[model samples]
Target: MYKNIKVIAFDADDTLWVNETYFREAEHQFAKLLAKYETENKIDQELFRKEIENLAYYGYGVKGFILSMIECALELSNYKINPKTIEAILNIGKKMLNEPIELLDGIEEVLSSLQDRFKLIVATKGDLLDQERKLEKSNLLNYFHHIEVMSDKKEKDYKKLIKHLDIHPSEFLMIGNSLKSDVLPLIEIGASAIHIPFHTTWAHEEISEEASNNFKYHTVANIKDVLRLF
Candidate 1:
């Protein structure tokens, strides 16, 4: 199915490294910080809603996420939250920023194997500087020919990327953990995609089974398994 593929774009978060797990952890940490204001469940729900609601203003990544947490805290606390707690929330984000890069198992193997056969690139959505910093720390930077820190991963975004790469949609393949952002959009644009399920997924990135039931794509158990397609 991937024989026509000339370029392979891999999503950064969760696909190449452990990302969603950190976000989940951050959410839990956030919940604890706001525990007096609301239950953890309510906090999670409200924070997710806030994140989606603020997407237009903040976009995606740690910076936006931190802002969402602050806003959620303010609302949940009815604006009664202490300034010290606000400082603590900011600290949560700082700690996440400084966390060490934990590369997924076999990620290097997959990239090393496929680098020579295809124009490998990182097509991910996040703060550009944060993504670049992670890439540099990953030491896997040299494997990719290009790195696109996209604002959003929609069909049009992929089309623009394909156009920039001077390749047809059919010749492009996206391998990532999020079906909503990485897989479905590519399939919609007539490109191929391989879904590598991550252990954790952000709520906004989840799609219903009904939404993906009609799509034709490949799902591998792991990143290393993607190599078997060739």
Candidate 2:
């Protein structure tokens, strides 16, 4: 099925290494810090809304998330949020930023096997500086031919990337965890996509069952399974 595929683009966050997990932990801490003001469920919902609202202004990444968190805290607290809590929130973001980049199991093995046979690229959305830091620390940078830190993962974005890579849609394949950012967009652009779900997913990345079945793409249990496809 992949005989025509020459370029394989990977999503760098939860797909290649630990990312969403840290965000989840941060969210938990954020919720706890605001527990006195609102219920955990309400705090979670509001934070999500704030994050989406801030997407245009901040784009995607931990930095944006941290800012949204602060906004949510202020709104939930009716602008009377304590300064110490704000400091704690900032510390949470700091700890997340400094977290080690632990590569997913079998990621290195699969990359090692495929790098010689195909053009590998990292196609992900995040703060450019943070993404670069993680990639450098990951020790997997040498395997990719190119790296793309996208501001948004949409059909237009993938189309531009495909053009820049000089590959046709049919010649490119994307593998990632998010159906929203990674799989659906590539499929919409006439490219092949493989969905390898991470154990944790951001709420925005979740898709309806009907939508998942509507797309014609491959699904794998893990990154290692990608080896069988190629």
Candidate 3:
């Protein structure tokens, strides 16, 4: 249904490569460490629910994410923290920091197919170092003609990205996982968006309605399925 599209902006984390799955695995390991102090009943759903709600306040990035984990560790430990346990938790974060990058299946083929038809840009928000490292390691960096890494994906960043690329809103499409960060803001700017939800923890941004005709929206189960749009 989409046509006349000149540029397509892709979210880097969950949209292009595997992100939340690694975080989920780390969370499970973190919980096992926390288990020594707090009961399963006390810290199960409540903690995760709070974290999801707090994402708006904290935002997403490794620094804030690691800080939240440290806070959780301190709270659960009742201040009686073990050095080794703290070390282990820090190690998990470190591992994530330097983790090997793996692109989601079919990402290369899809991008290659669309490269000649659309101007592909990597539009993501996070710590610059981490995001750059991930892109470099993933080897998918060269596919995107441009990269826009912002502190946040609000109107300001979207406007700047489009302006910098010299592309009009009608000619740009955003593909991402976070509705709040990627889809909604771009839609507000009169751009098209596609939502590719990952099977992992709750993202603060969730879509509540179907997309309107002026703005196209497509929701897919995974990254590989996103290729159908092009």
Candidate 1 lDDT (Cα, whole model)?
0.93
Q: After superposing candidate 3, which stretches have Cα over 4 Å from the reference?
A: 40-59, 207-216, 222-227
132-188: candidate 1 lDDT, tens digit per residue: 999999999999999999999998999999999999999999999999999999999
Off by over 4 Å in 1: none
- Listed in order, each prediction's TM-score against the native is 0.98, 0.98, 0.85
lDDT of 3: 0.78
Task: Extract clashing residue pairs from model 3.
Answer: none
**lDDT of residue 209 for candidate 3:** 53
User: Model 3 — TM-score against the truth?
Assistant: 0.85
Candidates by lDDT, descending order? 2, 1, 3
The RMSD (Cα, Å) of candidate 2 is: 0.8
Model 1, position 170, has a per-residue lDDT of: 98
**lDDT at 75, model 1:** 93
Task: Provide C-alpha RMSD values for all models, in order.
Answer: 0.8, 0.8, 3.0
lDDT of 3 at 179: 77
- Best-fitting candidate, scored by lDDT: 2
